[model samples]
Target: MTRSCVVSVGLLLLAVSTLTYGQGLLVVTDPDQVVRLPRPILIWPPDRPVVRPEPPAAYKIKQLEVNARLLDQVAQVQVSQSFTNTGSRQLEVAFLFPLPYDGAIDSMTLLVDGKEYPARLLKSDEARKLYEQIVRKNQDPALLEWMGTGLFKTSVFPVPAGETRTVSLRYSQLCRQHDGLTDFLFPLSTAKYTSHAVDEVSFRVTIESAQEIKNVYSPSHSVEIKRPDDNHATVTYKTKNEVPTEDFRLFYDVGKGKVGTRVLSYRPDEDDEGYFLLLAGPKIESKDNEHQKKTVMFVVDRSGSMTGEKIEQARGALKFVLNNLREGNLFNIVAYDSEVESFRPELQKFNEETRKAALGFVEGIYAGGSTNINAALRTALAQLQDSKRPSYVLFLTDGLPTVGETKEMQIVDNAKEANDVRARIFAFGVGYDVNSRLLDKLAREGFGQSQYVRPNEDIEDSVSRLYRRIESPVMTDVTIEFAFDEKHEELGKPVSRVYPKGSFDLFAGEQLVVVGRYKKAGPVKVTVRGSVAGEEQKLDFPAKLARHSEDETAGFIEKLWAVRRIGEILDELDLKGKNEELIEELVKLSTRHGILTPYTSFLADEDTSIRDTASNLRRADRRLSALAEPSGAGGF
Candidate 1:
C-alpha cells in the first residue's frame, strides 16, 4: 500500500549548537538573512522489500540565495531556499540542521512564505537521542555526521502534493580570528541529498572594518571581489544549474602599514609539526611620489614560426605593456631571431615621446629567422644597470633554441652571468614547439616564474593579464624571518620549509601568501624585509603558534601547505629528474591529506589500501614509468 501525508514544520529554534563541516542538507535564506536545515526524508514501512523497493521521494531545490553583512567580527547572515516535492505521494518531512563543531549563533529566526513558525529547541543530549532514533529506524548514517550538535524540532502540518515551499533563515554570529585574519565560512555542499541540481545559487558577502582591510582571499572558489575603499569590500559568487561540491571559505586581514602581514597556523596533533600560512601585501592607498620606480624589458621572439597570428598577438602584448608603463619607470624592448636587436641601446626612461617611438619600432618588426633565446636573454638582462631599481625581463619565445648557445644549462648560466642587477625574468613559452624545461629553468634560476600558452590561447591576454598584476611594484627582493623567544630557542628552528623558497617582490593591490612548517608553539616575531626604491625597509609583527590542535576551521591551512609542498616536489621531479626520496614523500603526503595528484590518483580506487605502503609504492612506480617524457607545455 502507498501512503500519502504532508508534514509542514512549524517554527523551530536551536541554541548553543556546535557548527562543523559536513554536507549541508538544506539551506534557505531570504534577501537579507540565512537559515539551514538538514535534508528531510519520508518514513517508509519496515517490511518494504530490501532490494527492489520503490525509491523514496525527495524534494528538489529550485533556487538558493545567501546574503551576509559583516561588521568587524560580527556577521548577520540570511538564507532563502525554494524547493518542490517531486513525488506524487504526500510525505511527512522532518528538517534538521547541523552546526559547526566550535561555532555558535547569537540569535536566529525562521519564516515560511512570510509567516513566522513557532518551533521548539532541543538541547544537545536530546538532539543526539533524536538523531540516533532517525538513524536506527532509517538505517541511514548521514545524520551521524552531526550527532553531537543540538537540533530544532517542530510539529508537522499538512501540505498538498506538487506545491512549492519557500523557507528563509536569518542568524547572527561572531566570526573567528587567527593572527590578524578573520574567517567566514558557509556550507554549500548540497548535491548528495537533493533530487536534482539546484537551478540557481548566489552568495554575496559585504565586509566592513574600522581599520583598512589588507588581504581578502578565498582559496575554495573563484569569486569576484571589489574594494570600494580600504575599509569596506564586497565578495560575490554566483552559479546557474550547478551543484556546489565544496563549502565557501574566505579570509581577510585588516591593519595599517606600508606593508601588512598576517599568519594562520594549524596543528592537528601537538606531537607533530604544524603548518602555517603567511599573507603579506602593500597598502592600498599611496601617493604618486611614494610609488616605487622600476625597470622593465620586454623580450619578444620574432622567428619564422611566429610569422602569422602569433606575431601580431606578440606585438599587441608589447603595446599593452608600453601603454601601461609608469612615469618614473625605465623600460626597453629586445626583439630577437637568429640575432638580437633592441628598441634602444640602453633602458630608456618612460615618457610620452619614448613610448611613441617605441610603438613605431614595434610596428616595423617582422618574423623571419631562427630563435636565438640565448642572445635575447643576455641583451635584455644586460640593460638592467641600476641595482637599486626593481627590474624585470619579460622573455617570450615560440620555438626551441636553434641558433646561438642552444644547450639549456649553458643558456641558463649565460643569462645568470649577464643579470648583474638581479632582474626577475618571466619566461613565456608560446606554443608546444617551445622547450618548456629550458624556459622553466631560466625563470627558476632567474628568480621569476614560467608561463605557457597553448596554440589556441591568446598570448596577448596571458601577458597583459600578468602585467596588470605586477604593474605597481611596491617592494623588491622581499624576505621573511620568524624568530622565537630565547627560552624557546632550544626547541630548534621554530619554522622551516617556506615556499617561494627565496626572495620575491610585492606589488600594490596584490597579496602574497607564504606557507611553511613550524616546529614549536609559542610567541614568535615575524620580520619582513624588502627594498623600497633604493633603500632597505623592515617591518615586524608579533604572532603565536598553536600549542594544541585547533578546530576544523583552521584545517585549511594544513591542506593548503600540503598542496604547495606537493607542487614544489613535482617541479623538482620534472626539472632535476626524479629521486626516490621525493617520490616517497609525494605518495605519503598525497595519501595522508587526501590530495590526489596524477601520480597518486590510485588512492581513489576502492581496492587501494592506504595502509599498504608496499602496494602504494609499486603503484607510484608504475605511474612514474609512464611520465618519462618531458611535458609538452609547462608541467605534467
Candidate 2:
C-alpha cells in the first residue's frame, strides 16, 4: 500500500499533506489497490504502522510558488508546486483538492505537466465522511481542521523513482471585505509535514482597483511593495531553505479623497468588547500646492565629547536636512555647547539664498565646551512663532547634560514651558551615555518619537531616513473620533484604549494604523480632523463594529491589539515607578497571548499559574528591578 497526498482548499484554509503526516502532506497512493479492496488501502489499515519509522525521503516538496491578481473585491490565484520522489520504488498517486466551504468558486482548473486532468467535485457531506474516516483510521487530529471543506478528487498518476512531478491549480473567487478594505489570505504553514526544509517559496500579488489604493499592509510578514500608480500595486515576498510558520495575509483600501480611512473589527464573544484597527493615509500623488508648509528647527549638540568623527557626522546630517527643505518651508538651526548659538534670530523662509547661508553655518559648527540640553531646546522653541503651521525640533545629543540646569526633570519642564506653539521634538540620542528615560519623556510630551543610533551606525543615515518621512506633511495635529449612531447612543463610548495616545501627523506616501477596543457592535461614524496648510480640515467615514466573529481570518486583529497593549504597559513600567495593577495586566496578557518579554518569560514554565495574579506581579517586580540599566545603544 502507498501513502496518499490530500490537498484541501477552502475559505480561510488551504493545506496539502500526506495521510501519514496529517495537515500539509504530499505523498503517493495506488488508486487500483484502493478501489479493489473492501477498505481503501490509503486509509491506514490496522496492520500498517501509524507513523513513518524514519524520514520519508520518497516524497518531498521542492518549491512552492503562488501568484495572485486582485481586482477590487475579486481575486484570481494560481498555485504551482514541484514534488520530487527519491525512493527506490515506483509509486502511483491520486491527487485530492478541496474547494472553499461557501462553494463560491467561479472557475477552477488543474494541470499536471501541462496536460489537463479531469477532476470530480465532492459536496460537503461526502468530503466530511471521507475526512473523518482517514482521521479515525490514522488517529491524527490535524486532519480534523479540513473536515468541513469540500473536495476535488483526481485520477491516478505514476511517479518513477528519482524524478520530479509538477502540479498547478488555478481558481478565482470574490474576496472578503470589511469596512473599506479588501482582505486576501494564502495558507503557507508547512513546517510540520516534512522533515527537510523546502528549497524555495515565493509569493507575488498584484492589486488593481477602480478607485485609488491608499493603504497596503501585511502584519504577518515583512513584504516589499511597489506602487506604479495610485490604482495599481505589486507586493512580493520570497524565502529560501525554510519552512513557513504562518500564513500570508494582506489588506488594502481604496478611496478618491485626499486622505483615505479604513476600519476592521473582530469580537470572539457576544458579551465582550471587540478589537478594531483603523488605517489612514494621504494620497500617493499630490500637487506642490497641496503640501502643508512646516517649520523645522534643528538643535545640534557640539559638546567637547563629540570632537572627532561624531561632530563630522552631525555636520553632514545637518547638510542633508538643509538640502531637502521645500521652497516655502520655514527653517532655522541652533547649535549648543555650554552656550547656545543660532543661525538666525527667527525662522526664515527656505529660499535658495537662505539655504546657502544655512549650509555655511552648519559647516562652521565645531565641537567644544560642555553640554547644555536645556538652553538648546529653549532657543529652538522660541523661533517657532507660527502656531498655524506644523513645527518640529530635531534635537540631537550624544551625552548626559553636564552644564547649567542639568536636572532631567527641570530640563523637560523648561522645554514644555517654552513650547508655546506645540512643536514636536524628535530626540536623536547618538550614543549610550545619554539618559534614555529623559529622551522618551521629551518625545512623548512633544508629540514625537525618539530614535537611537548605535556605535556602528551612521548618524547621517538615521537622520535622513526620518527626514524623508516628514518632508511632505499633508496634515498635522491629527485626531480621530468614533461615535455611535442615533439608535445606539446608549452604548456610551464607542471605543477606548487607543494606542498612540495623543494626536499624530499624517504624511504623504505613509500609512498610520491605530488599534483600539470597541464597547458595542453597531453602526459608527468616524471623523478625522487635522490641520492642513494652516486650515482645519475634517473627513468623515461610516463603519460597522462586528457583533461576533469566529472567522480565523479576523483573528489577527486581536493578536495585534494585544501586542501593542502589552508594549504600552511595558513602556509605562520602564518610565514610571512599578505599579501592581499594570504588572498584573501585563502577566495576564502575556500568558494568554503567549507573548514572551524579558520580564515575563517565566510564564513559559508549566507550574506558572496565570490565575495567581499577586504572585506574578511580585515576580515581575523582582525580575525588572534586578535587571541593570543597559549601557550600549539599548533603550525603551
Candidate 3:
C-alpha cells in the first residue's frame, strides 16, 4: 500500500506539471541573434501562450513515407520525411521528431543533398535545458514547458534555398492488446502544426505472427489489406496532397487456439533485468462455443432526460443485443425511470419468439419521470440469482439517481448486496450528465468495466461493441499461473504486475495482454486455469524468454510494461483520490518513461511552477553550454 500510494502521488504531480508547462512557448526573436529560429523546426503543436513571429525563411514538408513490420506483437517502424527550404536564402534548421512514449530510437540519419550528417540522442533532462535556452532567448515560456517531452532532436543543419533534405528515423514500439486485438498507432496528425498539407504521404505495414493472423482493421484512414494466408497480412495507406488531420490507428488479431497465448521477453544484455509481454485470447472463429451458457440482464435507464435521441439510440442498442443473442442463452431487459418495468417476469430463453417479444418491449419503452438508479439496479440484480451459470448485467444510464435512495455509494452498496451471484456488471454512462464515478465504482465492484459515451457518440455502437465480446464467454474466473524450475534460474519473479490484478472471466474472440518485469530470461512453464460450464479446466503451454536487442525487435517490452503499469496505477488513483506518495511515484514513472498523463500535462494555470521550471532550465542550459565549450573559453 505504501509503495502504491507513492506511485500515485508521483503521477498526480506529473499531471499537474504537464498542464502547467503545456501553455506553449512564447517565441522571442532578437535582431542580432542569427542562431535562434522563430518557429519550431519540428511539426509539434505550438506550446500555449503561443507567439507566432513571421520567420525570415519558411520550410515545408514535401513528402513522407512510413514503413512498419510487426514481428509477433512488437513493431519496427521507419519514418522518412522530405523537407524543402521554401523561402529565400540559406537557413539553419533544428530538426525535431516527436517520439512515442516508451519508444526507443535506434538510429537517425540526415541526408542534405544525399550526404549524411552527424546526429546524437539527448536524454530528457538535457533536452529540457535546451528548450529553456530557446525559450529564455525567445521569451517564450510555452516552448520550455513541453520541450522535455520524449523527443529525438538533431543538431542544426543547413538547408539550401530550393533544396530538399531527407530525414529518416528508425525506432520500435511494443503494440498493446485488448480483447484479442493489437493496436498500432502512428502520430501523423501534424498538418495542424503547419500552414498547409504535405504533397504526398504513404504508409505500409506488414504483419507476421507465430499464430495465424485473423483480422486487420483500420478505423482512422482508408486502407487496403492483403492477406496471403492466416499467418501474414499487409496493409497499405496513402493520401495525395491532403491535410493530415487524424492519427493512423490499426487493429489486428493473431493466433488460432481456443485460447491464443504468446510470451515475449526482452533483456538489455546477457546478464541483466528483463521484461515480458503475455498475450492470450480465445479463438476468433465466427461460430459461438457451445460448451457454455450465459444469463444476461440489461438494466437501462429511461429517465425523462433521455426523451429524445438518447432513448431512441438506447432502443436500437437493446434491439441489437436481442438479435445477437446466442441460442440457449437466457436474457431479460429492465427499463427504469421513477417506476420500474421488466420485459419479462423472469429470465426468458433466447429464441425467435422471445426475441420478437423483446423487441416489442423495447419499442414500447418511452422516456419519462425521474431516475431511480438504486431500485433499477436492485431489480436487475435480483434476477441474476443462478450461480450455476455465468451471468452479466449491462447497465445504461443518462442521469444520476434522482429519486429513492439517491446517495451514489448507498445505491452501489445496495446493488452489491442484492447481487449474490458473481455476475459481471458492465455499466455505460450516456452523455455528460451521468455520474461517471458511480458507474465506475459499480463496475469495478461487480468484476466488470465502465464505459462513458459522449453526447456526440452513438450509444448503440458502444453497447453493441461490448455485447459482441461478451456474447459468448468460454471461461469464467480465468486465472494464469506461471511456474519456474531450477534449469531456468533466470526467469526471476515470474509475474510482477497484472493490469486487472486478479482473476477475470475470458470471453471468446477476446484477448488479454499481461505486461510485467522479470529478472532474467529462459524457458518457462505457463498454465491457464478457468471454469468452463461450471467445471474447472486448465491448459499448459511452453514459452521461452529473450533479451533486448539493439535492432529493436524486442526492446519495446520494458516500455510496454511501464505503460500498462502506469495505466493500472492511474485507474487506482482515480478510485482512491489523491495520495502524496502515489503522486510522487507517478511523476518518477512519467519522467523516466516519458509517458504523459492528464495530471502531468504540459498545459498550466499556476505561475510559480512555471517560473521555477524556467529558472531551472536557464541554469541547466548555462551549465550544459559551459561543459560543451573549449577549456580556454567560458562558453560556446
- Lowest summed lDDT across 10 adjacent residues in model 1 is found at 1-10
**What is candidate 3's CA lDDT for residue 177?**
53
lDDT of 1 by residue, 66-134 (tens): 888877555667766665556575433334443321222221222334443321122223324543554
Could you tell me how far off, in angstroms, the CA of residue 468 lies in candidate 2 after the best superposition? Answer: 4.0
Q: Native-vs-model 3 lDDT?
A: 0.63
Model 2 agreement with the true structure over 183-278: per-residue lDDT tens digits: 676656645344456678788999997678889999778999999999999999998877676667788987645545668898877877788888
Among these predictions, the greatest TM-score belongs to: 3
Candidate 2: regions farther than 4 A off: 1-260, 282-285, 324-329, 349-356, 399-414, 431-441, 452-458, 563-578, 581-599, 603-636
- Alpha-carbon lDDT, every model: 0.62, 0.63, 0.63
- True-vs-predicted CA distance for residue 248, candidate 2, Å: 19
Per-model TM against the reference: 0.54, 0.53, 0.61
Model 1 CA deviation exceeding 4 Å by range: 1-261, 282-285, 323-329, 345-357, 398-418, 429-444, 450-471, 486-492, 573-575, 595-599, 603-636
> How should the candidates be ordered by TM-score, best one leading?
3, 1, 2
